[model samples]
Target: MTFWFHMNGVGIGSLKVYTNDQSGSRKLAWQRVGRQGPDWNQGHVRIDTDVQQVIFMATTRFHYGSDLAIDDIVMDPNPLVLTTVSQTYPSTASQTYPSTSPPRRYLTCDFEINLCGWEQDGELQWELKRGASPDRTSGIVDDHTLLGGRQYAFFNGHKAVNSSYVARLDSGQVFFQPGVNISFWYHMNGAGIGSLKLLQRTPYGNVLSLWSRTGRQSPEWLKAEVNLPPGLYNLTFEVSAQHHFSSDIGLDDIVLSEETIS
Candidate 1:
């Protein structure tokens, strides 16, 4: 059995699931406590014995302590099975399996905890901030990753001097095949906003511009997607800011995945 749940608010509380047998014996199957942020979390449980009843409970300390939400409950009779093969091979022989491993996402970052292996390079640095920018004259009030409950990478234009200031967030080297897609959410709002550029740095010390946006955009978060040719390269998000407090910019939820086609 599997289900998706979300929890928010102040106080202390828990979301619990129980299974009761025909003999009136009840056992706790799954449980979660505290806040799980603004995004939905997945929970799974396996029951070998017959379940006569299933119970879902949400407990809170006070009226405004916490809130629990559950959705998309799924019950699967056939659980996952693991198989092992035993083989005796000669010393001179070898075995190999082609395309047997499971598919995986290349890179995913929300900046919820930290930079997720990204590095900062330049005169100015990008800050890991929550809620809103320090100046508060521009930028988003909440992060784009989880709306009201997450942190994002932000660049403050107020720190710029008489000359244009440049800040960069660089990703580690990633192998890109055909149909690889990169997507991210950004918030560019302010009076003196400058240009935001996405550059691909190749292994041979070559830099290629992929995508870019200039000037002030909407106050809300906007999404951007880019598709690159097959190669090995590092991704750099470079932002050039003018000298103004209102030229703040934000970035969140960067994902790199393979696009499936029919």
Candidate 2:
């Protein structure tokens, strides 16, 4: 049990003290916290132990791999020692992020990729299929290439499609609006990287994304959103093939909503 006065960060200023103790050295005694570690070596305290010593120990979690260095220890006397100088410093939490913001949205574009025919492409193409849906109900044609059908990455009268672009929906969807929330669910097998968006065609490039990270990935639901500006937008589930010849991705059920964001 000892006392110490921290001398770090106090700019050069006169410290006034009026002590009645006759023996100054016997007034108080202290053992430094961490005499090792980078900060401690730089005249800083890493830990103030329960029972301190010149050779103090510290437990830490490192984010990087590195060899422990010996010269990281430092020792110096308190420049502001007095009759009794102690400090009850910070312990755990430093700061916290705000928790009241809107939550993120994750949309999953489940493939009617089966709409094509075989399990060949894993339904990963943006192209349309024969007897697809709605439209002429005739030949297989990409809805994005059709008139007003561009709303779909692929769509028709039978089955609807959500695109990587602005579009509409049949049932569950973010329902593009100026003040709506959007998101997507995703499971990619190749590259983990691709741009997902809730984009406006007016500005033509307005966007949103669930993940920007790249690597191989498993299929899963991932959401993203955008606050539109008086035009149409869709919670588009866009993905790029991982050029590694590892095949394509498989997606599950996709859902978009106008629900409150987190």
Candidate 3:
């Protein structure tokens, strides 16, 4: 049987799949396959292993120093686990709560109109981001945006690095893995992309996704169903992103859950 480990979450999106053999002690181990997303994904090490369990981990780090609107993490290890039932955002007065997880946001031009980033309210404020422009909102309702930017986010020989520039998301402990569906209200522009995905691969070799981007560009927020891939995952509303800045993409009301096929 194909056991899928699924998980999904907002902010520093991550999905930790612990495959402990039936021994209840034997941990799961996965070899390197590939990568996705525009984050600084790290490599995985046999962090620890013994007659008890073997543990291998991959880390994804966002570059574009801006908070993104991530909703879930899905991985299909055995059954599936996606969609965050409920969460509590502590301190409404703070932008980042409990600065534990390093910020997963890295930009290119630092913003000014030349470059843009993500946000929590789906707003883009580079300057307010630290070393760019001011905290500004998208002047346009990019339900169908056409962003035009270079491809800085990609999977490397084993490391997915947006070395120079990449998208961003809030900093916290949010993960996705071993699931079947991830619903995100995404918008796209007319531009195109090499690939736009909900999953961002890293060197450690892991699939942190719940319906990701392998292709690029779409004019509307349509649902995407991924069957043949690292695993099975689907989308409710059709959504697309050419993985380009000019392709203007925005995702809102994202829900990571199983979309009934009835």
Which numbered prediction scores highest in lDDT against the true structure? 1
lDDT tens per residue, model 2, 15-81? 1112223333221111222111222111222122232333322222332332222233434332111
Better of 1 and 2 by lDDT: 1
CA deviation > 4 Å runs, candidate 2: 1-124, 127-175, 191-199, 203-213, 219-230
**Candidate number achieving the greatest TM-score relative to the actual structure:** 1
RMSD of each: 16.3, 26.5, 15.5
Would you list the C-alpha lDDT of every candidate in the order shown? 0.71, 0.28, 0.29
Please give the lDDT score at residue 226 for candidate 1: 86
lDDT for model 3: 0.29
TM-score of each: 0.57, 0.29, 0.29
Ten-residue stretch with the least lDDT total in model 2: 114-123
Candidate 1 segments exceeding 4 Å error: 1-106, 260-262
Model 2 Cα displacement at 235 (Å)? Answer: 5.2
